[model samples]
Target chain A: EDKVVQSPLSLVVHEGDTVTLNCSYEVTNFRSLLWYKQEKKAPTFLFMLTSSGIEKKSGRLSSILDKKELFSILNITATQTGDSAIYLCAAPNNNAGNMLTFGGGTRLMVKP
Target chain B: SQTIHQWPATLVQPVGSPLSLECTVEGTSNPNLYWYRQAAGRGLQLLFYSVGIGQISSEVPQNLSASRPQDRQFILSSKKLLLSDSGFYLCAWSKGWGIQETQYFGPGTRLLVL
Candidate 1:
């Protein structure tokens, strides 16, 4: 079975602090890694990393995948209270039925 | 742009009761659909997926079942609700079978079985 593990299951940080979330995977027929930000409802798509070394960035959030290391990291800069949410990482399995194996997720809390 | 929707934002049902959750997509044609369940503090688990109408594929066998009737409509049904079924149910969609394609999620339906 494909497995995805995330580090620091939960974290609390003050405003303006920087946080890095980590996700490592052991998957079959690996294709890509995806990141999402979930508040109280559905998870919103953040970034999709298909290559190694190249980082995908948007505003205060950026992510990079290290295929060789079989891991990915999400970086949040100058965090704000609004940045608090459960960050999820997923990897797609290329078997018969296309599916994504997701990590347990990292719950982040940014306090002002 | 495409959008996905799920109905009955919240539901509370007794054990052995029936269930029917609906999901629909707009502005897209022949999209792949999926059903996922997430327990408290757990990751999303794929329950079922459909590549086309009446072509449902079960990921994990359980009390739940799914169906895709129209091009954009998917339904999740259960003959009998189990307490273990109480959780957040999410519906998703993608463009094709490409493993690299990103799946978009719905608002989700919170089901509590007592």
Candidate 2:
């Protein structure tokens, strides 16, 4: 079975602090790693990383995939209270019709 | 642009009751559909996926079953509900069967079985 593990299951930080969320996976025919942000409802797409060492960024959020290390990291710079939510990482399973195997997710609490 | 729709937004049912959750996609043709369950504070668990009509693949063997009656409509059904089945159900779709495609999700339906 494909497995994805994320580090620091929960974290609390003050506004303006930087946080890094980690996700590592073990799967066959790995294609890409994706990051999502979930507030109260559904998760919203953040970034999709396909190649190693190339970082995908959107405003204060950025992510990079290290295929050789079988891991990915999401970096949030100058975090704000609005950034508090569950950050999810997922890897697509090639043999399972491209179904995503998601990590347990990191619950971030940003306090102002 | 494509969009996925799932309803009702929330439901509370008694045990042994039947279940039918519907998912439909618009502005897309022959897309790959999927059903996922999310327990409290946990990640998504893949329940079923369909590549085409009448083709369903289950990732986990449970009391739930899925069907694709049409090209863009997928339904999840259970003859009898179990208390453990209570959770947030999500519906997703991808452009194709390729490994590189990204799956877009619906708002999800929260089901509570008491």
Candidate 3:
């Protein structure tokens, strides 16, 4: 079975703090990794990582994937309360359903 | 721009009641549709997926079932709801049916089975 694990299931930090969320995966085959931010509703797309080493960034958020290491990391810099949410990491699997196996998710709370 | 919609936004029902949640995609046709459930503090679990009309594939075996009666409309149903059925139900769509395709999500429906 394909599995995705995330570290520090929950985090509480003050504004301006930097946090690094981790996600590791175990799949029979590798395709791509994805990041999503969920607030009180549906999750929105963040970044998709297909290659190792190179980083994908959007404003205060950035993520990197390591195929050999079988893991990925999402970094939030100068975090604000608006950045507070459950950060989810997922990997697309080679299943007939075109499914994504997701991590339990790292819940980050930014206190102002 | 493509969009997906799922309704009713919130539903509360007694246990053993029947369930029927509807999802539809607009601005696109023949897109791959998927149904997922997110329990409190858990990751999204794939319940069903449809590659085209009348082609539904279930990922998990449970009290839930799905149908895609139209190219853009998908439905999740259950003959009898269980308390375990309470969760956030999400619908998604993708242009292609591939592991690499990016799926866009709907606002989601919150189902509460008491």
Candidate 4:
């Protein structure tokens, strides 16, 4: 079975502190890894990493995929209160369309 | 611009009652559709996915079933509900049937079974 695991299920950090969330996967025919930020309703897409060692960045958030290690990490720099949300990592298998195995997710709480 | 909409933002149903949830995508054609369930503070579990009309694939066997009656219309139905069926149901869509394609999600429906 394809599975994705994430570390530090929950974390609390002060404003301006940096945080790192990890995601590792064991999938067959791996294609791409994606990151999402969920606040209340639907989750919003953040980044998509395909090639290993290549970093994808958006503002204060950046992510990288290490296919050899079968893992990925999401880093948030200079965190703010608005950055508090559940971060989800997912990888879609090549044979399954619209089927993505997701990690348990990291619930981040940033306090000011 | 494409958008997905799910009906009945929230629902409360009794055990053994029937269930029907609808999801539709606008501004796209022959898109791949998916149905997923998420427990409280947990990851999403794939229930079913459709590559096209009349083509449905089940990932996990459960009390729920999905159907695609139209090109962009997907429905989740259950003849009898169970307590374990209570959760947040999400609908997602992608442009094509491929792993590289990015999937977009709807606001989702929250179901509570008592």
Task: Point to the candidate with the largest DockQ.
Answer: 1
lDDT tens per residue, model 4, A22-96? 999999988888899988888888988889999999999999999999999999999999999999999887664
Model 2 clash pairs?
Answer: none
Instruction: Using lDDT, give the best candidate's number.
Output: 1
Instruction: List where candidate 3 sits over 4 angstroms from the true fold.
Output: B97-100
Tens digits of per-residue lDDT, candidate 3, B1-114, equal 888899999999999999999999999878889999999988899899988899999998998999999999999999999999999999988776444377888999999999
Relative to the unseen true structure, what is the C-alpha lDDT of residue B71 in candidate 1, on a scale of 0 to 100? 90
Instruction: Name the regions of candidate 4 deviating beyond 4 angstroms.
Output: A96-98, B97-100
Q: Against the true structure, what is model 2's DockQ? A: 0.68
lDDT of 1 by residue, B1-114 (tens): 799999989999999999999999998998888999999887899999888899999989899999998999999999999999999999999886554379899999999999
TM-score of each: 0.97, 0.97, 0.96, 0.96
- Error (Å) of candidate 2 at residue A34 is 0.9
Clashes per candidate, residues 3 or more apart or on different chains: 0, 0, 0, 0
The interface RMSD for candidate 1 is 1.4
Per-prediction DockQ: 0.70, 0.68, 0.65, 0.66
Residue-wise lDDT of candidate 3 within A1-112, one digit each (tens)? 9999998899999999999999999988787888999999988999988899999999989999999999999999999999999999888778666777889999999999
Give the CAPRI class of candidate 1. Answer: medium
lDDT of 2 by residue, B61-96 (tens): 999999999999999999999999999999999875
Of models 1 and 2, which has the larger DockQ?
1
